[model samples]
Target: MIAQLTALERTYAAIILVVIMCVGVAMAVVGRGDLFAVHGWIIAAYAMAVMVVLLRDIDAPEPWEEHFREYYDDPTKVGIILSLIWGVIAMAIGVWVASLLAWPDLTFDAAWASFGRLRPVHTSGVIFGFGGNALIATSFHVLQRTTRARLPDQLSPWFVLLGYNLFCVLAATGYLMGMTQSKEYAEPEWYADLWLVVVWVVYFAIYIRTLARRREPHIYVANWYYMAFILVVAILHIVNNLAVPVSIGHAKSYSLFSGVQDAMTQWWYGHNAVAFFLTSGFLGMMYYYLPKRAGRPIYSYRMSIISFWGITFMYMWAGSHHLHYTALPHWVQTLGMVFSLVLLVPSWASAGNALLTLNGAWHKVRDDAVLRFMMLAAIFYGITTFEGSFMAIRAVNSLSHYTDWTVGHVHVGALGWVAMITFGSLYALVPWMWKRPALYSARLVEVHFWLALAGTVVYVFAMWNSGIIQGLMWRTYDPNGTLTYSFLDTLVAMHPYYIARAFGGLLFLTGIVIAFYNIWMTITLPAPVDEGAASDLPVEPPAPRAWAQAGE
Candidate 1:
């Protein structure tokens, strides 16, 4: 069975096993305390499990035939599984943090359970762990299909997938250990950042190589958005994470920039991390999956091209809006604001294009749960972008900044746009990847969709109301020009909204849990057999779809 594996697969397995063993030994020898020791044990146990799996596969019989051997999807399968796992973890943490806000004593005085430490865990887990893996997986799947070419190599895909997840693990664990460079959305310490750089470079190389070998003359618009996401994220990550590590073994690091410069640099990274990482990559998913599921061509391929370039160009300049009224130069702030407002054009263009593509498919959008998710995501994208532009204006920023309004806006995109699109894509892909006819439960899909929509709406409204109330209270002045409301009074007022936010998050999480179960059963349950079948033979797979055939 081991002999059945391609040489590359065997080599990868051996290398991973060796690396895991070496890391475990090193940690056992020089780990600082119980935390490090426990981590080492976990690594060792995981390595052992991996070894067993490899050995079992080695002993299995080789396949008699290898049809559909042109494409690589194992990495995608791994990514989807990891994405679901991380989604649960990220949302659970988010709910817990919301609870912390509502009931401050929920932390129980434990440092590790504090909101500050866990907040990054939620953000990084969802963005990088959940969303990032989905992007990586779908990008590979979509890029290959759109280009009509296979990935450059099998090993590189595995390296990027596994190595990227490793970076996520390091980032999440480091946060728990109080190790960070203090950069929003770039919280991973110096070493973790370096690891991600290496992984990202390999990903880029694989993508470019595959594109170069494409059978199609025109690169699909989806690939363009995906490429932009990869290129810009690499540039932003490296630039923002230029820090000096205390030592090779230690997690401590100091940023290369300081003071006002540091603040500007951090927000520059923060905002664009939203733009490229969260927005662009998922837009790539939207472009591919939406049309494929809707059975229609893109509304305007030309508009997609325009929106892609416009968004990429405009987003880089808009980050400074985050520093409105800060020590950053006034002109720079204004520049950020102007660019942010201009960003609405391309944002709405993309959203409109997506919606217009569904012009004759409204019935499908209404009937199909997956299409509903994508359509809602596109709609939310427009709403969030419009709101973001409005809030960037100086006058609006004066009220929204330092308030939960910004939080609400972020989730309008994060939960409504990002997660919704991701869920839709996964619903469309999981059965295909597993060679199933359909989802295990369509009813569950419908249920999950309504839960997600309800949860997101409730969550956003609660935050918006709390934020406006807080802003009003802060700005209210008495007849004598003294503050009318104290800070504690605002906190007391926010308690109800915070509780609502937590309840909303719980609803969202419940939906995710249902999704996970449905996917799990879809993959594991035996396919239903035909009633009148005479012989006991495996069913032949269906022929490829038109788009898939064209790509090939």
Candidate 2:
């Protein structure tokens, strides 16, 4: 049966009218609500409806038809490519910011080019632009694979990718142009925020409809993590970006919250943005790609569910940890610290589960670069989570707050863990999508791994030692009890470590360049044989399983 939404469509229309009436009555009752506020809601709802209608129109084909129907290559492919390109650029900007912190004079005293403006640029590019695009691309890929259905709609995937990139371009350019709301991660001007609202809603619809048509016995474990990320981020973005624009072009705006309340709101948005954006979203990639690359099933099906909900429950409370030793209430800070410590249990559960899943397939790690990437990503995940919980502790916070240690911890996750897994997944996916026999150069992939690994090791250790030394120097007191060392003294000591960190970043970038060449060659080679066509060719005898050969 060709599906029809006739009755549901009528209900949707009627609900919009009732929502309008309710808003009118509430505005009259409250006496402070404005026409503009209600108008924004009405327009937002209508745009959502249009998207739903469009989603239903495309009628994505069955999976078996993918090869023959000349599948449009899933418009999400463009989003994945954008994610990879932006991942490099974002990390490059991060390296620039890291360099600035190490050598403050790198800015050369230009206002627009200064560290303060570029800091937000670095953070947003990596988090929202790079991390966000990775989540979108992988979710589309995972959803289609699990559901055994083609992507739900045509125009939607393209709309999402283009609209999102437009948002990124606008936000990046606006920051350089001195346009912002001065919020940390939410600094984009009101116009750009509004544009994101549109892109995100389309993303939500695309995910939901794909789930609705799924043919699997149950939704896979990975979808749970991806769905949580999608859901929470929508709520977070809307609440944090509620502001009154002075005008579209000039970029001035007023937040809905004021004073300490505003600070509270900002960190609340900030930390959870890290939670949902970096932690939850990457967990999605881990669940799917980790097992697939290992050529094995996940160790425990039930454990995945338990940890998913546990992390979700625990992480939302840990956001207040950022406000510790600040004007925020003591109880709130304590609550955050407690939750931060508790988060370790669930986080370790996911990490351990990933490693244990490879129990019988350990040698795959030596042979498969993709497997090696995933396994090491799990190892880094463990290190980052432990460091994160320690930093949230008040005792450690006293020494490490505002130091380079924070930067090191973040890169352990971003570069060592998240970027590693994403790269491995892309390596696996590109060949599959292009239907290539194998990567053009496995040796190149191995070389890329060593370079990235060496870079991350040097980068993290340099920051760690320098940060601890700086903290100790500042806290030291002479016999006179005068301030022991001026802040500048600590800065002078950090030059060598800073130089090392920059060189490490260059090594990591070089690895990515090698990967680009290897992948490009693989895709451009001769066409692969179709599964049906391969039946006409002779088959070779299979090698004995590794475990069986070892036994006797």
Candidate 3:
């Protein structure tokens, strides 16, 4: 990967790392005796190590002329690997988290391992660490293909990839150290959030720059969704993380908004983080790879347009539904509920468009586990989006709020939609990326598909059961008008379902393990040349651009 850069580029990379190292050292010195100092040391050591690698490779040869002709994919490759590793780690932690609730003594007296601290580690790890990496990696692949142009530069992709990972590392480690601003989904401290803002700006710049370099007459739908993901997420992260740090040395901060404003700001960020980051980005992946793999054009281009605009316009307003029946004014909640229900139109449109694209590809769906993964993901997308709309209603929110139903709804999206589509895209991408005819073992792919499906079903079902029982128990009353069940009673009732949820999560994690191994073997093992494999490689690399020929 380092050899992909020119000598000058390598030197530039080293210089960038030098600046990061200096920042880390300054942080370490100023934040002595604090956990923030630990992160400083981590950052410094990481930067120094990467800087050394760049320096050692600084004099190495630049890529051949053929390199600039092709898409820059090193970052995507590394991003995929990092994403898989994080997915396995985070999903395992998720299972452990579920077990903690069931047993309530599984922490083993470790403060860092407590449910409060580790839950965010699990959430942020999978969401940002795993899912974020996948989105960035796949976006690079989709963008270059859709635009018929290479990335604007090599170094910026790595900068965005590594810098974003640094933010993930900071957020995860800080959570373990109990350093949080207490906002859901935006838990990282002020410095980490600021670092992300810087990284995201560069990411957005890279997208715009690449689009400017496109040879195509028009941007593809995939780029539109990916751009929305990039643009909207940057806006959401910046606004929600606006905080005043107590001191530069301290890993603590107060939000710019407080009271109900803080609550509103947070859910706004939270919901749209789901909208753009999880839904929109993966929809981009779907728009590209799903049709490509199925050998069909999208069913309705106009519907795709409707889906994009509707989601973009509506999702921002739906966040207030999360505050239903709270101190937040009823009108705001009603507005949120209305938007949430209306969001179903575009949500279903996107889902329907994906499914209809497979009209004549049912044979492939039957024979190919990879396509099955994507198809099920679309189905789940439809189901979960509908569930979200249903739960957003004030009456439904009353039962679902603070219950395991909400958790179920999220996992439907997380496990069923996000993870499924990601794995499907990766499975489709890995062989093509590694230049293999097919996977190392098709049987393993089948095994993984079934495991993932079974896991999602069991997990969601268990949560649904757990949530409804809890909701009903909490609201049930005796003749004396007192609640019939204590919170503990609900816990005891949901204990079995928690165990089931954990087991289901374990199944899902096992599938990811299988996927990682399958992908690793496909990359490492030699391909057997055969007729079936010869025609599978893509033929989309455009003629080298004029500036690229000039070695710019």
Instruction: Look at candidate 3 and tell me the lDDT of residue 477.
Output: 100
Best by TM-score: 3
TM-score for each of the candidates: 0.92, 0.82, 0.96
**Using alpha carbons, what is the TM-score of model 3?**
0.96
Preferred candidate (TM-score higher): 1 or 2:
1
* Residue 44 lDDT, candidate 2, scale 0-100: 44
Q: How do the candidates rank by TM-score, highest first?
A: 3, 1, 2
Checking candidate 2 for backbone clashes, the offending pairs are: none
lDDT of each: 0.87, 0.76, 0.92
Residue 543 in candidate 2, Cα distance off native in Å? 38
Give the Å shift of residue 541 in candidate 2: 30
| lDDT, model 3, position 164 | 96
Residue by residue across 218-281, what tens digits does model 2's lDDT show?
9998998988888888888888888986643234679998877788778777777777888888
Top candidate on lDDT is 3
Clashes (backbone N, CA, C under 3 Å), per candidate, total 2, 0, 0
Task: Estimate the lDDT of model 3.
Answer: 0.92
**Lowest-lDDT window of 10 residues in candidate 1?**
59-68
lDDT of 3 by residue, 1-552 (tens): 687787678878888998999999999999998887888988899898778777775765666677787888889998999999999999999999989988879999999989999999999999999999999999999989888999999999999999999999999999999999898889999989989999999999999999999999788898899999999999999999999988999787899998999999999999999999999999999999999999999999989988999999999999999999899999999999999999999999999999999999999999999999999999999999999999999999899999999999999999999999999999999977877788888899999999999999999999999999999998999999999999889989998999999999999999999999999999988777677666776554444343333454
RMSD of 3: 3.9
Q: Write the per-residue lDDT of candidate 1 for residues 1-552, one digit (tens) a residue.
A: 344345557667768777876776676555555345444555566566667767765534333244234567778988999999999999999999999999899988888888889999999999998999999999989988998887876667877887788788877887887767778889887756877898899999998999899999999989888988999999999999999866544556799999889988888888999999999999999999999999999999999999999999999999999998889999999999999999999999999999999999999999999899999999999999999999999999999999999999999999999999999999999977777778999999999999999999999999999999999999999999999999999999999999999999999999999999999999999876665442343344343223334456
What ordering of candidates by lDDT runs from best to worst? 3, 1, 2
